[model samples]
Target: MSKPRRWLVAIAGAVVAAGLAVPPSAVAQADEPIQDPLPDPVPSSLGLTVAEFAQFPKTELTPPPPDPPPDLRLIRHARINHLGEVPDGSGRLYVPDLNGRVYLVENGTQHIYVDFKAQFPDFFSGRGLGSGSGFVTFHPDFKRNGKFYTVHTENGAGLTKPTTWPSHSANPFLHSIITEWTATDPSADTFSGTRRQVMRIAEARQVHAIQQIDFNPYARKGSRDYGVLYVASGDGGQGATTTEPQQLGNPYGKILRINPTGTNGTGGQFGIPSDNPFVGTPGALGEIYAIGMRDPHRFSWDRATGRMYLGHIGEHRIEAVYDVRAGDNYGWSEREGEFLYKRNDPQCSVYPLPPDDAQYGYDYPVAAFDHNPPPGHPLCSDSGHAISGGFVYRGSIAELRGKYVFTDLVDGRIFYTEASEMRRGRPAAQIHQFQVYANGQRTDFRQLVGDARVDLRFGQDARGELYLVAKANGKVYKVTGIKRFASCAVGHTRVTGSGGADSWSPVTPDKWQFRGDSVILAEAGEARPGPRRPFEYAVLDKGPAFTNARVDTKVRLDTPVEVTNRDVIVVFGYASDTEFYYAHVSTDNTIYPHNGIFAVNNADRLRIDDQWNEVMSRGAPPAITDTAWHDVSVTHCADTGEISVRVDGELLMTAVDHTFGAGRTGFGSFDNIGRARDFRATGTAA
Candidate 1:
């Protein structure tokens, strides 16, 4: 299979199927039809839900050396790539940082297992996207053999060092090397071992050298793939104009299968698996398993179904996930996510597929998303999106079961599709966005990271539980649970009781003014003699007692905006004047009693909301900074004792407790003048 014949076969197959009798000269003169490469926008409304993630107690690692170029896309304090439970079953997890250290973590403590950067002075990193310790994986029998492997990149060594493949780039910029290590004691926390080079290959450029390496976790001890290693190699950033992926002579743009313990490979470094796809093909590398990829960033095996999936980052148009199989050709430099990709076309790099595209024998994505940039940004640039590979959730979260969860590398938006719907030949599965929450308040990864680009990654443990790595912040989070709220049976209702107790009941009736359907806190509540508490608040006696309640109302601070102490409140779980919960929506949050969800139980109100800074005894920014009317909502769930407050539809704070249940709802002010109207309550009636 020569390179020229491969191109001719792909082109000729499409032309002959069209039944055209045109000569070669005429075909050359006619312009080739083009197609739009951008994928359809993801489904907006279907399958939308929130996933609750909790941070580990104390697992922050030391920052890596500063990136020389400081490119935000690749910059991070610690470029932590992945996390996996050690094969020895110590119930401990090992995390690999691209800057060259593998840390064994247990009970929020980190111990250095290996220091590749300190050992190998020639190691190169912090200069480019993937120019560091790439990945590490343990052999299935690691407990017995004490064997493991790793991948890393080098700069000057690539030009001078001998490589396993002779057909490498003449002017190589970097080289990716794989090394196998033998540990003296498998159960030890630190590594005391000797390593040997398994394989090395020159890279054309710096960006996409080699990303990940691993073994299929589901493989049995007697299976052929039990200890076999799979290395995902990229095109080294040269596939756009050159057919680097299509060529079969080199390991670039392909997945390679080899045996680390055997010595029958090139230069006697490792063994090329006899079952590899190109073992007998003339002029083809025996190690090639699958070819035709730009940057196969990550790959994983589904434990339940024994299926392999790969996440590939495209040049401009698509970010894809493939149902990978042995010998499959994922067309790159020719097709991008089922659409034609025009090489070196600066203005329009993607086009529609030809009618006879099937004859080319190119496989396509099973779940994919398009690059969506802001209004003025470039259409075909790296600013938009990249696909970060993820695992199927067979974890403890029942709602996330059977979904192939993944994320966008740039904006940190998590997404997923039905793993059962992902098949090789069908149209791509529909992608849906997953809502995220931390500390019980709704949030996105961008907000959680507090950065424009999240630089996010995913990892899974032996128990099938998932973790999220923020490369920008150097933190790991466990997917603790899922948040699913049941709807209230009472639905929605409004208050209008002609100034009677049926609509509103003020604790201190003399301090409040009531009209037809409105109540005003005419005077400020006096300071208590002992424990501070809201001396005046109105309870909605007309509504049924609710176990799970949602309160909606419009509030206006009667004082001037310059009065920084002014506030309005929404009360729920109102068993009595001394036992209730109130959302203190105030103009100033610098004090302990303002702008938070507080609970009173015969004592000073205690702050229980997630957003409160416990050290400072303060909360987030002011919820009511002006005198204008603002919509407020207070939600309470007696079953979980979860309460959250929203101002103008944005989440302000959240709290959880079991102090009270099946109570009334109301509105007022803590110690300032305010007015409330259009009050409503919806929930499961007691």
Candidate 2:
């Protein structure tokens, strides 16, 4: 494979996103590792969520441009095809490209581990959806067994299945084959793996030959699901509007299960698991696990909570997500999502529920949003098409645990929903649109992603951290929790704050008191005050001195007055009280410079920018009078003489000046009362 490429290209704009807001405060506790830019929230009315998403660092996959389908918005095959994590504790991800290559992703870097083109040149030189290499899954005991499987299209060569498919199209050599390969040294970077043709299905068409193959991740060693490989096959509906989606005679449009090992029981190369639903059924193929679906593309087994969420791209109107089960028939062609797509048309016909609809023999999608969400749509169509299924968050993120994180490929609409109601096809999961904030601007999911046909996909590492695999962009992104500190990457430094002098360290400590880890500053005995005694700063001498970096803290303004010229302030970027930068977080935004940025120079203090526009400072969350401990951070980029301040993870100010460089960071209040703690600063040391 070519040299590793830097796959994740930073989105062109700053994204401000809203997300699960627990206030993300560690002020009350001492050892809560504070990772900042933590999710602050926007009103639920915005119908958007702020969550953390970062591009998977390092690994890159670059392929030559434009495969056959020219006008097709995205390269039908090149887009992030699929993301799978090896069961091995190495935290490696196997990214498969339909264009014939396997990427082993580890620690932000990807190495070409399997080169299909080089290994089997003539075998994969094909096009269209079903003509190339597709899904890949490691055997359950792959770590010890070194076994894995792949699905690809082959013509003429090891012809395992006959060409007498259910279609009239006399196409020879075009067959979809499932093959198993064994690695000599599974843990090595590049190993010579020998392959065996597992099973071959003669193709009728190309569009939906097959979709994905997933081995149950939650199954125990001796459980029924342990060694069973579940494969989703489409009806190969390339030409006709629909056919065979509901037909069990042919394995198309149905999810099939088989034992990759052992002898054949149902005429296929691989042995059929005796527990399969259709084994003794009259006309149904013994391998049929479930039926009545168009293309069962992306499916994931939630290891956290036992749930199977499958996204079946709709024919025209509705896209769906279903809690798949054995023997269940998910209606397709007949009904899309919960809608009655077609009653009876030659092109496509409906399989109505038993008249009273009492028996849901043909299951409806559990959680499906409208493609456009038209007027009567369940979600009433906000944004998105083509669903990207994700794993249930079982990681450290307390709020998102057990919540399924999924996205729409067309609009990049990210969402997290409860699984229980969704599994039984209850009212569409209360969809909460996820938002992304990067650098400065909040990003709308639609704008952050590429093409419409580009069905984005999601993956989870062993750690349960989710990742996005984009088809159009061919990039992988790791979804992480918010960080509370500024990396100061552009400023060339990244460091943390050092502990400071106790509130008793200063002489005029009127009402200021320190409790070892925090400080409380109140204007005790001094009543009805104006902005007197300009800067009453409490410096943390332990914070690393930096020429360019960010300082952060959780502050609670306790003053409740309606009108007061005084404000609580955090002073940083200074040599002493005479020269420093202070953020005056005040209760009222009615007056200019009242709640804004100011700098002290030669004993003269003034607003960094005369006009208090968004370029300088903005209102604080929950009216500064509210006693909630909101996060406040000030970042200085020495290279550009720029300074920015963010409150509760939202950028509120951007100002530039060459006044001060290196200094000790601290917090303070001027003629007002406030409590502050969890003081931290990370950036390059001066």
Best by lDDT: 1
In model 2, the Cα lDDT at residue 64 comes to 35
How would you encode candidate 2's per-residue C-alpha lDDT over 56-138 as one tens digit per residue? Answer: 22322223335553434434435446777888676778877776667787766777777766666345424454456777898
TM-scores, all candidates, are 0.67, 0.58
TM-score winner among the candidates? 1
CA shift at 491, candidate 1, in angstroms?
A: 5.0
Per-model CA lDDT versus the true structure: 0.74, 0.61
Error of 2 at 339 (Å): 2.1
Where does model 1 exceed 4 Å of error? 1-70, 166-168, 485-686
TM-score result, candidate 2: 0.58
lDDT of 1 by residue, 1-686 (tens): 21112322232112111122211111221235333334333321212233423232222212334645455565565777788888888877888887777878786567778887777766777556777888999998999999989898776645588887643567877778899999999898999978988988888777778898899988999888989999999988888878878877777788888888888877799888888766766667778788889999889999999889999999886799998877777788687766677887865445666655655677778888776444445655665588898998898778789999888877788888899988766667877666576776556778877887887878888999888877767777778777543222434544333455556788788898777567788898777565667767888888577878888888899988888988888888888778888889998887788888898888889988766755444576689888888999888878767676878876667676889887888887867899887777877777
**Candidate 2 — worst ten consecutive residues by lDDT sum?**
13-22
